[model samples]
Target chain A: MHLSEPYLSRRALLSSVTGGTLLLTLGACISGGQEPSPTGPDPIEPVLAASVYLADRYTAAMAAVPDLADRLTPLRDAHQAHITALTRELGTVDDGILPSGRPPAVAPAGSESTPAATASSGNAAAPEVTASPVPLPAERPAILADLQGLERSGRQQAAALCLAGSRYRAALLGSIAAARASHAEVLT
Target chain B: MTTGDEQLAEALRAEHAAIFGYGAIGAKLDKATAQFALQAEEEHRERRDALLLRLSQRGGTPPAADPVYTLPVAVTDQASALQLAVTIEERVAARWRSVLPQAAGEDRTMALDALIGSAVLATQARRHAGISPATVPFPGAPA
Candidate 1:
């Protein structure tokens, strides 16, 4: 959808306004920060996955139009920086819940995947995982269109994520969304 | 006013400033750059009007625009004028971004759209100014 359109219709807004008022009143009655919530899946995981996907797309674009490497490399680098920032923000998700969620290949009790081994072998690095590059488009127009679509999708996802519970997460997501929108504009 | 309303009001104010700021910048630039500035100014004006209606419909009175604003940088030549345009767009983008989390549904959507619009405009301004790597890595975030 074009960015200018309102997310909800006027009728929906009216109804939501009433419901939101009640919710706000109810929310005020409860003391803030009194609940100790359990950590769920890292919300950044999906965003990180999206960043990787975007980076892979950039790589594919580079391969498809090597001459455009000068342009594509910076875009890819931005996604890489996003991955690093998001990972750092997440602060090592329970190894049990890797971003991929594929359950670290059934390692033995003393293996690297095991907490005991990880603790004993201080400074031991995790195995590096790589994403497969995307396939090439048949022509330059197709490639630009593909990248443009990917940028648009990334922008939408990041905008939705901008309302995340954590302020820092929301800020990061907003920045990514803005960056993606600029990318789309550049492509155009 | 609620936090969201206050933030939205602030965004409206920024839009008012941007709409005014473009008038100064547009005069100093070449035909092409002036065209971009005119288009961007119109967009900001449209956004401002929309935000005013939204605020009023919510029973919140929108802030009045100041007659003038002090530019972060002076606009003398075409180069400086372009820089001023970039600054205005970036400031407007930041204002819209601050409203996002506090807003919901349509308000949130409007904030996101405005933020993105300002960001793209800022990048365009930078490109027109012949800046290298025209787009910032993070448009609205504090550096």
Candidate 2:
């Protein structure tokens, strides 16, 4: 549904009213010695896992849709870039390392089984681990939706990572957020 | 209710809802749209799993998904679907905001960035839907 005109106007009015105050509050919050939280092991590992997962999915998508291969190639490249960047950052951090609790069971590519079957096999290896589903759609709209979702998810994970990391990590996450924001705009 | 675990549960709940919402979103669009839906669904799945892992690591049982969730509005068309997406992102952003107080350091920055990113995505969705005031005044303001 469309935003009601009144609602839009009210939002604008409210923003105008509180804009300065919010900025000042944020500034104070930043200036105050409220040092950012340390990166905890529980949070960082999943984000890294997600980055790797997306990169793999993108590779699969590119292979499945040769027609959109040229278009999607850059997107896949971008995800790989993110994976590298996040891995490096995580390497430097002290907390939030995913426990060697269990290795993620990844199936061999192009095996006799269907992608879904392979994914299921992998899942069986690590019963507690849940991953994004395999067997994606090859259509452009479907692909775009998946990409947007991936970017949005990445933004969330990056935000979490930023919170758990240091100033450098936060800045890195902010940049990632900017990229995801752009992805949302272009993917649509 | 505002404990770290509780707040994380809420965030995971929102992720579950968003994942479910993508099903409807995927149905309304063509192949191009399906791609976006597929990716979004995967992302939600990953986030949900991560949240579950986090809860388990803390010795808490992960929350289960609700049998159904109430959408803010019907999503019969592209515009409406995007609106729902904007709403989902905003809600998740709110959860991040709540978690910020309880979190420090990297977690705090991450939450702030997530909030900002959600706000940006919501604004983009609005603009794509041809809505006026394309930019939301506040990205993660309540409701």
Candidate 3:
């Protein structure tokens, strides 16, 4: 039985045949298989790097307080998952993982000179402290709240990263974003 | 109303909401967690600023944030609060996807990545909650 070219009209068939030949010629013209373009650092790399640093902090916390290990293990794993997914997509990873080299001495909420200082330094300045810097809260509720907040922040950063890297690596960024969102929920 | 500018405006709105949500989430967190939340908030602020700059560069006015944003639910417990956070990120991802059609190359890639990342995060959260369908079928692709 002969199959009819219903899908491919005469003009379409001619174009396809021509296209195929052109593709073959083009392939032969190039010596090596199309070399992957030298990709620059993806915009989302910094955020993923930050997440890895945060994951390390969580791991440290878990180690320090064995009781919190169960609570933080999955979160830590998720961050690791994100780093893997992002790095794989970017084809490179940044050496630095921390979100800025040094931790803030104080919060940015109640600082007078902090804005000016940050502007001059071109980095976030440590804000003044009105509230006392007590030790980490002991209560479960307080601790959970903190964890939830941290996860939310991580999710936001991931989301931004996804936005920044969506076009070149949709699948990778999507996976990372989803993981961050999941972390937020788990922390809550 | 649904011009490129409008799409950008919607994205900016999502950024504002995210920044505000981080504040609520930060309140209950510990030192390390609080620091992360604060940094995330700052990042969103920076992105919002960049959006405004882009808009102005194109001779368009950037959208303003509302006086207050309404939360999907009260963040009374960690579980509920995290659920809300997940939802917010997903919503933002959806909005970014909308803007993707108009964007190209790097910008488009950025939007796609953001959407996917948000979806992955949401899935992780769901699994933590012991829920089925932890990850969505396609996090940032067209529905």
Candidate 4:
């Protein structure tokens, strides 16, 4: 039950970590996660943001197409895992759920009917993939095409980021990108 | 060889094994799946050839393919064949995933292509084998 002196806030911890990493990466500015300096954006932010955006897309899709639940929910859960990994790397806290503002239109009926997406998850204890029972009846083809497009763009973005990232980061980004590419193939 | 070159060699080895594995898989499959296996084999051949050239251009004697490989599962019937197919794709995907961190430019691009390709193929094979949630969160990452 021991802790840092003066109960230093989480921001202080994050700042020191970012500052140390920035020294090697930037070699100039000695800023950290707290102080907004001229380092543009945290490189992790873009991929992290992309994962959040992709999760939202999944939420919308699941809400709009209930029958595709069995299909789409697992992909969405993968994004959740991606978000967890990225956030963990950034030294940020995440409960490992969908990131959003407004509440979901339809809440999950239950996790009982859902399946785990562990075939890809590195975390053995990763959460179960869940879905809602929304009554919307969209055309399956159109919905699928839209999802395929989302996955293609997401994959490309992550792939580009992977190329520019550090060795460790590259592996993480590459895996996430590969998942999206597979998603596109599945949708096709 | 540098790390990237080593990774390339490892991935190439996987490609070679996959080409051989698919042959075993195809023999037990029906016409539809046999055609599918042939296409996958062809793709692996192209990759293996490309990697062989890359290693040679780096001024080293590229390693020759193994005379044979011991498959993890027996391929005596359709069910086992499909299982072997999934197993091959999974192993190939794992090899490609290892290459991403070391690879650059053309190597990186090809690694990504192979990783994604194996992942997609794995899903299809899983579906054919009747595995649910055929898709994965991170295709090439360790389970």
In order, candidate lDDTs are 0.66, 0.53, 0.51, 0.67
The residue-level lDDT of candidate 4 at B17 comes to 89
Work out the iRMS of candidate 2: 8.2
DockQ of 1: 0.35
Highest lDDT against the true fold, candidate: 4
lDDT of 2 by residue, B16-115 (tens): 8888887777677657655655665776677788778867887898789988888886989877787787677767766766666665654455456556
Point out where model 3 deviates above 4 Å: A1-188, B30-36, B120-134, B141-143
Question: Residue B95 in candidate 2 has what lDDT?
Answer: 71
Instruction: Provide DockQ values for all models, in the order shown.
Output: 0.35, 0.07, 0.14, 0.52
Query: Which candidate achieves the best DockQ against the true structure?
Result: 4
Per-residue lDDT for B5-124 in model 3, tens only?
677777888988887886677666556445545665666677678777877877877878887888886887656656666677677778876776556545555555555555554564
lDDT for position A4 in model 4: 15
**How does candidate 4 fare on TM-score?**
0.75
Residue B10 shift from truth in candidate 4, angstroms: 1.4
TM-scores vs. true structure, each candidate: 0.72, 0.44, 0.42, 0.75
lDDT of 1 by residue, A32-113 (tens): 2221235434444445545645665676678767898877777776776675566556554343223232222233322354
- lDDT at A7 for candidate 3? 10
lDDT of 2 by residue, A56-84 (tens): 56667777776766555555555545545
lDDT pick, better of 3 and 4: 4
